[model samples]
Target chain A: MLIPMAKLQIAGRREELSAVLEGIYRLQGMQLVDVARDPALDVDAAGLNDANSLTQARLELLVARLDALLALVGSDDRGDSRLHGDPDPVSGAVDLADVEAELDRISILVQEAAQHLDSLTDELAVLPRYLHPLEQLARLVPELAALPEYELQKLGLDTAALVLNTSDDTLVDTLRRELTEVFGVRFDLTSARVGTDAIGCLLVFSHSDSARLHALLGQEHVRHLPLPSAYSGQSLFGALAGMRTRLDALPRELADAHQVLEELIGPHVEAWHVTLAGARAELEQLAAAAGAGVTDRAFAVVGWVPRPHVARFHEALAALSMGPLAIEELPHDERAHSTPVLMKERRVARPFGLLTRFLDNPRAASLDPTGLMALFLPLMFGVMVGDVVYGTALLLVGLWARRKFGRISPGIADLCSVLVFGAIWAIIFGFLFGEALGNLGKNLFGDFSLWFYRGDANALQPLLLFALAIGAAHVLLGVVLGMWQSWRDRAHRHLLDRVGTFAFLCGMLGLAGFAAGALPPGFMSPAIALTVVGLVLVMSLHGTLGLIMAPLELLGAIGNILSYLRLAAVGLASVYLAIVANELATVGPLWLGIIVATFFHVLNLALAGFSPMIQALRLHYVEFFSKFFIGGGQAFIPFGKSHS
Target chain B: MDIGIGLIAIGAALAVGISALATGLAQARIGAAAMGAIAEKPELAGRAILLVAIPETLVILGFAVAAMAILLLPA
Candidate 1:
């Protein structure tokens, strides 16, 4: 049922307005409307900018900062186990100065920690550069250190090492020859055999000849290992040992930095989320006040509260102040064009309500079709997919999906509910049609229908006729509902329009039956008489054009009814496909046949599943909804409420 | 003179095949636009599917015609 709303206009002293708004926000029932739009109230636009504007702006800034902090911590409210157990009570107004100070203090610590982590990351990145050379130097450090240190310095020499690991022994001899004989550079080549196919050599060359000798040995797969600037002129073993110690300590230091940052931020995440929620609630109240108009002494606020909530709204405000306050319920006629719509849906129908909202909310004064949709949509779907085996499979899949993903997304849960309902209908129709998975039941039980034949093409007439009957009933229901709405609104002409259409449908069906030789000849008189009366009634309102158009409307209604034949038609197709699959499966050996049949049945189930759902929704949205539903009302939004 | 069954087969084939073709042609455009709409707003997926399935009425009509052909054949 769609909830009826009453317009709530609350007037109170300007000073008490904040407290009143807080009380309403806590109640979480009233959907606030802009009072400036209400022409009956003499609202001062400039007076809206009260002391709350500056405070609201500050609160908005704080919320943004807190959001950034939450993101930085990489945690969301939904994933937290603590948030699931108990709901938080609404907090009192937070002092802006206190919140600003807290956020500022935390933000500074977070920035400093982040900077520390970044510097550690930067140092760790460069550590690999030093570590790679330090490892190589550590391997060859003793050999180079054993050389006469004074002579090494007295020769004004600089050192370069080459670790040759490639499969090129000739390149090693060429390097030794190039430095000593061909270049005639003062260089000492101290070579050490490291491993099979790898040789490590250290070159101590005169400073004047270092550039030429270095360029000479640059090729031939000789990798020049350069030491860090700090260890360049130091004793090779001492420098290697010192660098290795530093390299070993860097990883531990990096780990400590990470652990420290995590420890600083991890414990505070829950507290920050709660603080942010409280501050956000207060901020939203300030925003509502900014939209409302106020005077020097009193302020006026207009909003919609469901009729049942009127007493609660009054009681909450009364508790705020013992002094008399003006609370008036505006008449329904005074509501603005964009009145928010609120509905109290039945629990069973709540999931189906997702489909209704998928289209648009029903108009505030229009009839709600959610309850009817829950009944017809699944019925239409079941008729289309009438097969027991497929229905059971769909039921199992829907049940599994509901358990796995129901909490993750409301849409998935709604879809699961729809699927479960469709499957139940499918099972009922399946039993009636005697189809387990296509002709499997027919072959096993000798092909007899429990209610009516649906297995062969020759047996499709009954299904088609049944579909037409269903369409007639559905269309009649829509027409009756439209007439009821019209009667409620006291639009006699609209009511007449619906009644004429209803009469026209009866007359046309009767005539069609007579023409098909399914009705007695005597029925023609009443059929023609009814059709003429319907035309006259419709023509009364639509003028001369209605005389010609009313008959076309009757034909259109017939077409709409005939359109339901698709339900039977598609079901027949599914049955035929399943039969073909069974026949094809038998073309092979026993094991192969079993595999083939399973594959085909699975394919048929999938194809048959989604199409019926889509078609059922289409029948409801187009054929059924076209009769009465006029949606487009805005959904109700309570003050300070956050949509998840 | 005894070719009634063959003629019925041809009629049923034409009915089902041609209607399927027509539905395919109509759904092509609707499906493409629905996909584009869904890309912009995922909430439109349910409505988009309904729109895309509207053209399937052609196939249903064809199936009905084929069924009629088969059922109406003389024994």
Candidate 2:
């Protein structure tokens, strides 16, 4: 049901405004409307640009920081929904300064630890590049302590290193010969087997000829290997040993840093969340208040509050001791176009309410269709997926999901309830159809007493007729809902139009049956008479244009009814697929047959299950909702809450 | 099978096969647009699903026609 809202204007002394707003925050039931934009308010409102007013950017920054802190401590609640939590305490009672200081300290420590871990990991990653070639060089030449500058100069050389595949050993000789000719520089090169397939080569050339040697090497496609900064000024063995020690210690150091950060912050995660939530709630209230129009000494806050809670809201305001405060309920008629919508439903209907929110919230004046959809969607689903064994499996899965994930999210629990309801309907239809995973039960039981006729080719006509009848009833209900909406708005012409359309549909259906010789001769005359009367009535409202549109409306209604044939058609497909599975299984060896049957049955179950659920919802949204759902209402959002 | 029965079978196959192709073609476009819509706004998932399922009626109607054709055959 759509809850009625009463418009409220709250006025209080400037000094006591925060206290009054805090009381309203604790109530957490009013959606504040910006009174500055109210046409009734004077254009020359005072204190609109008050120096003391909090800026929106500052409020956002505070909220973001709190969110960052919550995430850092692993207590972020951005999209995760927990099914159970303690009710919120009253607003702005606790001081968050000490927690803020602790959060700041922990944030810095965590950042430092993260940075240190990153560098260590980076060092460990590149260690292999240096270690691999150096280990090979040490093994190939046992006393090649380091590159000797004197030995290097013997060939007019300075040191450089190159890595290559074993095939590229020939490329090194080419590089040496090419360099001697192109750069006129002599070179000495040493090669070591680094990895299984790759060789490490060290080259020496005259310092004066180094630049020419590099160009010549590039031309020969010889890649250079530069030693890491840590390896500089150390012998190959010493650098290799140093790198091994660092690599071994890095993992332990990273683990210890993680342990320390976790130990420091993990215990306080819950407290940090609560503190941050409190701070956010306060900041949100201030932001909401900043939108209100103010006089020299007082502020006026205009908002919409649920009608039943108006008195309770007043009582909370009275406790604030804001002297000579004015709290008045502006009639809903005053702001009909802007009234925010709040849907109040019973606990059982809550999940359907969530589903309704997928579309726009219903207008404040419009009917809430959550209850209607909840009742009908599952019934349609059951009819379209009639199979007892499949239904039972669905029920079990829904129950298991509800039990396992209910505490994690209420939305998921509600969705499971919808599935459970559909499963119940499925079981009912399954019995009616006498199906269990495509006649497996019939084949095994040999004409069991519990069986109804299988929904085979013979049952097609009656099932189609049944689906049409359901469509007719559903469309008629939509007409009634339209009339109810018209009645609420006191639009008598619209009421007449809806009633006329209903009569026209009835006459059209009656005429169709009579023309098919399915009805008595007596029905023909009255069907024609009803059609004329409905036509005249509809024409009276829409004038001559209604004459042209009336037949089109009837056609649309007929088309909608024909659309329900999917229920029968999809159900038949499921049965046929199940039969195919059984047939395939029987063709092979017993074990092989069982495997084939299981595979096909699972595929059929998935298709049959998901298709019906989606089709049922589509029928409701397109064929059903078009009747009276004029959605575009703003959802009621109360101030002083971090999330709705 | 009799010639009449064979013709009925052929008609049923044509009705189902042609309409199934039509449904697949329609759904391919609708499903892609629905996915793009859902990526932009996650809450649109329910409505997108309803839109994607709308084209399925083509196949269902074809199935009905096929069933009618099969019923023309003798038991």
Candidate 3:
């Protein structure tokens, strides 16, 4: 049930304001509305500031611990289970203090290792300089053996390897061409810009292998001249790439270290747990101190306590000298806008609370209307569907779904129950009409057949008669319910209005029956006159114009009766469909017969099942519910912990 | 006899077609409104779907009638 709420306006010192709001928060289920303040008058509470800072620090620690845990879990399919399982809450709280200490230790160790690796790589980059002279000998021996003495002497002069820096492009090009032609050895130019306007190269045989080149490049002069570092850009990238294996293992290593520290400080976890317990106790005491007294403010703290808790909550508040807090009980009305069945009793007595509420409310007396609607809704549904086999199948399916799914929505469950009931009625009616599947006149009894017609006869008159009878009963029930609600509400005139309408409808029905010769002439003639007079009197009771509109009202009532014929039509259609399915199954070839029968029967069943369910609800909501129901109740909004 | 059967078949087809067209148009109108509401508050999807499907039952009932007419008539 929707609970009516009042807006509360509070004015107090800021500290006192916060204290009151805190007390309100402690109230189990009271929803506070528009809690505003005048900033100038409100003093910021010292305790609130302390609490805020403590909460912020706690949150930061929690985030850091979470990040560390995520890193340990890794980014892979293996980590999925951790996401699904509940974390050990005890372990979570214990780990926070250790995490900071462990992080500090690991950070220092990682920094030292990183620096050592950097120095080693730098040393390796300059190693080539020391081995250069040996490399020069290796290159010289291979080349000199192939040369003549005079050529060797000339080469020897060039071999002295002058390290003069050359920026002169012409000189460098001339030297390169001369070397290529005369010695068949390439000039290997190793250049360095020592300062502005200085460039240098060491010439060597192009045929010299890498081993000889490495040795020659390792010479004292090359080392002294500051040759380009071997581990410069390329080796630095390689070093970084290799470090990934180490970096990736960091989490596991830290985890192992953390494990060792955890074992060492295992007793400390207990000590801290004790400390936390003490702090919580202190906080609670402080909260109690703050809530010790109540000021004479216009507004009082309101909240919801389960019906059972109300007494205890009231006692507790009174103990604190807060006096009595007004408690309003809200009913759990599941329907979106239906009136709540407020029980005066504390204990809920029924399995279906809403159903029980209906039973209790005298205004809802229309719900148990003489079993006519109960009998008619299903009867109409069965007639509309019209197949015993299909109806039986629907009953079984609905029963199974109800049993298996337990309680779904009351609306859907109620509808299914109605369909199942209809199916039962259809089976009985199908037998009576000698219609199986859609054979309207087909005799299952063969020699015992009572009807001779083979197919399609106008059953409209009987069906229409049945609908009209049912419609009269339905409308009468509605009037009765309207009168009952009015009587319950003590609206005496409304009760008279309902009774007058009911009498008028009965009279009209009698007159029609007499005209059709279904009733005695004297009996129906008097009823017709009496009905007209009653309607006139009832209409005139409210005003004069009602007497003039009585004829139009009677016509409208007739139109309403005609609407019930849809029930018969839909029922007949169901039977007709079932018969067609059976006929198709019987006539077709063996395989075709099976296929056609199955498809047609299944199709018919689906159609029959859904059609009545909807139409049945429509009749109830529009025709029946409209008579007395005026739903617009507000839903109960309680202040409590949301499980979601 | 063939012509009689053909006429029944045509009638059944017409019934099915008209029913389906009616359902389609009604559903489109109701469904568009329901979808707009769903966009505004997605929590209403379940109830909206049920409400939108209510009128479509008439088409299904029509289909059942047409199927019966087709199969029951002599071929």
True contacts kept of 2: 0.55
What's the ranking of the predictions by TM-score, best on top? 2, 1, 3
TM-score on alpha carbons, each prediction? 0.77, 0.81, 0.48
Interface RMSD values for the candidates, listed in order? 2.3, 2.0, 8.9
Kindly provide the TM-score obtained by chain B of candidate 3 when compared with the true chain B.
Answer: 0.89
> Every model's Cα RMSD, please?
8.9, 5.8, 17.7
Lowest summed lDDT window (length 10), candidate 1 chain A: A81-90
How would you encode candidate 1's per-residue C-alpha lDDT over A1-644 as one tens digit per residue? 67778888888788877777777787777888766666765686423355667777787888888787676556676687535432353566666788688778777888887788777677667757755544554465555566665655774766776777856767667777866675564666666665577666777666778677767667544687666666777645555566677778878887887676667667777776777777777777766786566888887778888888889778877776635579898775512347788866788888898899887788887888999999999999999888888999999999998999998899899889889988999999898888988989889886555786587645667788889899999988988998988887788998999898888888878997899899999999999887777777887778888878866776666666767887887787788889988998889898998898898898899987788887788888877887788677778888756722
Native contacts matched by each model: 0.48, 0.55, 0.00
- Indicate the DockQ of the complex predicted as candidate 2: 0.59
- Candidates by lDDT, descending order: 1, 2, 3
Please list the residue runs of candidate 3 whose C-alpha ends up more than 4 Å from where it truly belongs after superposition: A1-379, A403-422, A428-436, A440-459, A490-500, A534-556, A636-644, B1-75
Stretches of candidate 2 exceeding 4 Å from the true structure: A38-63, A77-111, A118-210, A213-250, A263-274, A319-324, A333-337, A446-452, A490-501, A528-554
Of candidate 2 chain A, the 10-residue stretch with the lowest lDDT total is: A43-52
lDDT of each residue in A1-644, candidate 2, tens digit only: 88888888888787776677777777777888766666765523333245335343444554576676456435555432421363364434445456556657777877786677667778879998778776766565443445553443454435567778765567667656766676563655677667777778776556777787778668767677766887764444556778889888888987886676667667766565565566566666666667676867878778888888899888877776667788887655622667788888877677778778776688887888999988888889998888889999889988999999977888889888888889988988888777888788778875442434454546777787778888888887988898898888888998888888788778888998898789999998888887777778887787778778766776676677778888777777788889899999989799999999999999988886678877787888877877777677788888754443
